[model samples]
Target: MVDADQTFVIVGGGLAGAKAAETLRAEGFSGRVILICDERDHPYERPPLSKGYLLGKEERDSVFVHEPAWYAQNDVELHLGQTVDRIDRTAKTVRFGDDGTLVHYDKLLLATGAEPRRLDIPGTDLAGVHHLRRLAHAERLKGVLGALGRDNGHIVIAGAGWIGLEVAAAARTYGAEVTVIGTRPTPLHSVLGPELGNVFGELHREHGVRFSFGTRLTEIVGQDGMVLAVRTDDGEEHPAHAVLAAIGAAPRTGLAEASGLEIADRAYGGGIVVDERLRTSDPDIHAAGDVASFPFALFGTRIRVDHWANALNSGPAAARAMLGKEVTYDRVPYFFTDQYDLGMEYSGWAPPGSYDEVVIRGDAGKREFIAFWVKEGRVLAGMNVNVWDVTEPIQNLIRSAAPVDLEALADPHVPLESLVA
Candidate 1:
């Protein structure tokens, strides 16, 4: 059990780390809470970095998890711009990079999160090439693409995932010519399936964003240290003033690996292995957010989710577990995104090839619909696009896990609440 007088250390200053500090204070923990972060800024949310924040609709101050004064007010120590050299797990100390400072902790939480995956194409290091994983990256992109009018600048995005698509929409709103290249035929098809993925693709196409499906980026062409275009495996080159490589992210697990924590099996993306309670192999340490590959009770499998909701929910759960409380972090996975006029909320988990059929309740062509992925008549997952106020019903359907009538589920007249009834 963690004593109130002992020090508690949290690594990484993302949403997970901020929430852990919030929870500790709320739980009346008087221990010294030190938050070590590589970024100089206080903990802030990342979703807006791509959408509203990048588009200039949201202010910088609004994205922060808490004001800078909150940490001081709550007695949480802020260690900004410090790189963690190593975790001396045997000695229960975290060594700093520059000055060799050792911060001792009776209990530790690892929320190092994940880093954006980089493309290894020839000109990836060019000046106009960018990746979006931090505020600094988004700021750089805003400087490059913010003021361009329609067709004034050509922007090539190398991935069709959520980040790529969201930035595409934002760039389009600024009137830039955008082209998205993806190995998959449709954007988000792996998660939402081809039917819904096609909806997103068509939506983008209608707004003048081009697509190069089933192609791989072979090289980023450049001269004078600035990107000029991208060449694909299909022998086609697309002109570009700026390029964004939104090819997804990989869990930052180097600290866990070095500290000898059990790395999750490769099947689970090789993150730090944790139980349902978010406890790592060592009782004195715990990991949450994207770095922890935890056993998900609802899906009956181990998984690591790199979404905003998981980080928001799991951070507090890990804090409670670290306090020696018996708790299970069993909340269903959820995530939401906004691109162009389309807004979507998805709940539950059903990986690609897991669901046998997708049931639609509204007009997909019109962009207002609720889609459900069912396996053996049980609703494994559901998503509502541009459809509001039914998230509770969708979540309830997934939690119940009861077989539903396909005809009724597909009928718009049938209230979602009645399907589970």
Candidate 2:
């Protein structure tokens, strides 16, 4: 039933869109495939931007999802530096670029990703103000960090979330003065809750990262269009040669909205609403990655995950589904982070207030431990810090949904596999 005459079009050129193109060909679909990207650069991964690439540990070319030649080799037509601004759902056609080149698609995939939330304060247009969502931004910030390190300059970050903390670690490693500001009592309070989040706060403190918790940025005080310092709502000002707005990101769904697609509200992570098969309200159109809010049967909720793991897996799942294969995307949510000497892998979802108790196994002080969020004795989520080879067992325990012994769960001597029935 593979129609060689039909054309499949994918929007957004990030990891998800790229993987979808690869999957289409792998499924033996002898059809025309077109991939459109707004970014001029080839589709690349975003993690290294705040991790190794920013830290000078990784090369520039290592971030791309595939070699420049892969698209042509796989017969995947790539349209870079262009955008599909309008989609005529009635006609099943998309218009792109200034010329409004129209392309008819038998099935369309929208992998449009999210963008960093802009700082609401004044002086954000200053030269030294930066956000690390795109490669161009990271390339600029990398040099800024090196210059700050050489001159012993200071940087005041506006948020204590993942991007803020990761950038702070890189800044300190580069020998720049660092201070982090957050509205939460502890970092990652929304995701990890206060008990475990305090661990990260203390780790950053030990590494010379100053914290101004329970507050937010008020204004970026600058002179001559260059950031000089930042003022907080608490009436305190910190000298800052540079300022990073690590607030958060919002899903890019203007195209979906313009096309009158069903977009979920902020409560559901604000993305295109997709079914278990990754099909949107319009049956012929699909969504994935940070832009797809789908039904997660295991979590009993329609959730949207804005992380690397979701894009890496959901893209192919959606691709196979688009190819007329039955697909139920119930893969356990997974994500990892590396800051300084601590490397952690987190699986499953346990939003704050959703879990009753958090059990710790191994030595937390040494950063070699696994923390489980449990509700009524059922494992809800697990995060392993400086631990290895435990993701499978952690995910298995969550999937089993069997109540576990609190004492055994907290004991390092017990094997995680034995507890899952």
Candidate 3:
């Protein structure tokens, strides 16, 4: 039974951490709930950092998980700008980094999230170099893009993953010249494979975004502590006013590591290892969001996804489990992207080389289609581009794991639900 004496402390106040606190209260927990964040801003969603907020399509307040007043209204103890340096599993307490303040917990949830992978090359400390993993970063980039647009400046991006392409689209929208550098041959090559990856590459190119595929940034040449240009591995120099390191993000696992939490393999997201119920090595401590790598029953492997949907659903799942409810977080991996006129949703996992082939159900040339990654006559994953209301059937097909007729799968006339049946 929960009581006024009981306390639940949540670390890392991103969408996952904020949602977990909300879920705890919704599930009728009257205990003291403390939500802590390293960032000064209130808990906010990450997608808008690259898509809407940076594009000037969304306002500053639109990205928060809850209004500044919601925490007070809900009686949730909100702690911002405080970093939890050490988690003492034995003492059941977390110590603050700045002031060394201690907070005890009956149960603790770590939703530490992820940090953008930094470019290892020199001049990263230059004034114009930026990373987009936080609200402050996006806010800075938004202003930089506006200034670049006004000054007719060029921005060189150091990766062609989702963040790179999304930032490219936003930069182009602001009339700034964008040059994208990637080690892979196509944009999003690791996620969508070559064929569909080509589509995104072409999309950016059509919007006047330059691609330096198969190459990566080697150095950020700067002057007076400001960026001047970037040099690539191929001995080509591209002049730039700003540089964005969109390589990807790594899970923030330092606190977990220091606390001696079991960590997963580096190749598989390198996050804190958690069981099916989101319980860590210590039963009193649980994990969620990008930091927790839990066993995925559907894939029969442990996968840690850094998508917004994972943070959206996993937080509540961990909260429910913390409240002594049975929870199996087997939600199908889901992610979406909106670039220019194209909006796409991808479900299930189909890493590179894992699928036999990718089949497209509609006209890819028309910028509309459903791409399925098939493995041994079974649909391993599906991506619907500019399609509507098909997420349910697509997720159902993935869970079914039944052999499907490849021909019927590619036919636009065939109903996806029928194939699942």
Candidate 4:
């Protein structure tokens, strides 16, 4: 039984924090709910930041999780633009940066999220260099992209992950010369494997995007304190009006560390360690979203997923756990990405070097396919590219863990449901 009068303080005002607050209210917890956000805006979805929002296809209001009126209606307190300085577990209080207000909580949820990884290379502090982790960053980059539409601008993107690739597509759509620099031989090689990665590389190449693969960015050259060009280890200088560093993101766990919560080691991506129920070492404190590295029952390993779906689902799971409800965060991990005309939806966990074989079901050249990663004759993970309305079957196959007929799985004529049946 939850103490209805106890206060619940949720840190980090991203999708996870918003969803947790919603869950608490939906679960009939008439308690004091306070959401602390470092950003000025309320919680909003981030997927559109790189795609629709950057491309000017979507409006600003559509990205928000809830309008201002929803908070007032639900009786949820919003403390925006306030950074949590420290967490004193002994006092059950969290110190804020703005005016140094110390707020107490009977239960706390840390959704501090992650920050964009910054490069130590030269000229990174220059005016036109950008990193897109927040809406503010996206807004700044959107301005640069707008300039590209009017002028003959060149954008040099560092790293070949999802953000870098999506931005490359968006910049190309706006008639900018895009150059992507990556350490891997192919973009997203580690996650999607080289075969599927080459397909994306081909997609970008078709749109006139250049790739300097298997190279490192040594410096970002600037003129008048604004980005002008980038120097790669291959001794080549690529001229650019803007630079985007999308190498990766590091989990924001300083408060969790200061409060003596158990954190995963570097091997597990250095996030807050949580159990199946999303409870940290201290039962009073819980974690969710990108910050929580919890045990994944299906994969038999601890993993932290940094994607929209995880943040959306884990928030409620953590909230339920906090209320002493019997729950298990066992949802299959899912993520999706859109680039140019290509859209992909992937589900289940197939960690690098874990899958034994990959079976493709459609033509990679046509950019329509479903790829499955199998281990020990069981379907571990599956990805559908440019295919719609089949995620349910793919997820069902993964959950069943049944041995599949390779011929039937590869045949487009066979309905995915029949294979599982």
What's the true lDDT of residue 49 in model 2? Answer: 97
**Candidate 2 vs 4: which has more lDDT:** 2
lDDT of 2 by residue, 170-276 (tens): 99999899999999999988889998998999899999989999999999998988999999999999999999999888999999999999999899789999998
For candidate 4, write residues 59-126 as lDDT tens digits. 98899998889987998888989899898888999999778889999999999999999999989989
Runs of candidate 1 with Cα error greater than 4 angstroms are 1-4
As for candidate 4, its clashing pairs are none
| Candidate 2 Cα RMSD (Å) | 1.3
With a 3 Å backbone cut-off (N, CA, C), the pairs that clash in candidate 2 are none
Local error of candidate 1 at residue 24 (angstroms): 0.1
Candidate 4 residue spans exceeding 4 A from truth: 1-4
| Model 2 TM | 0.98
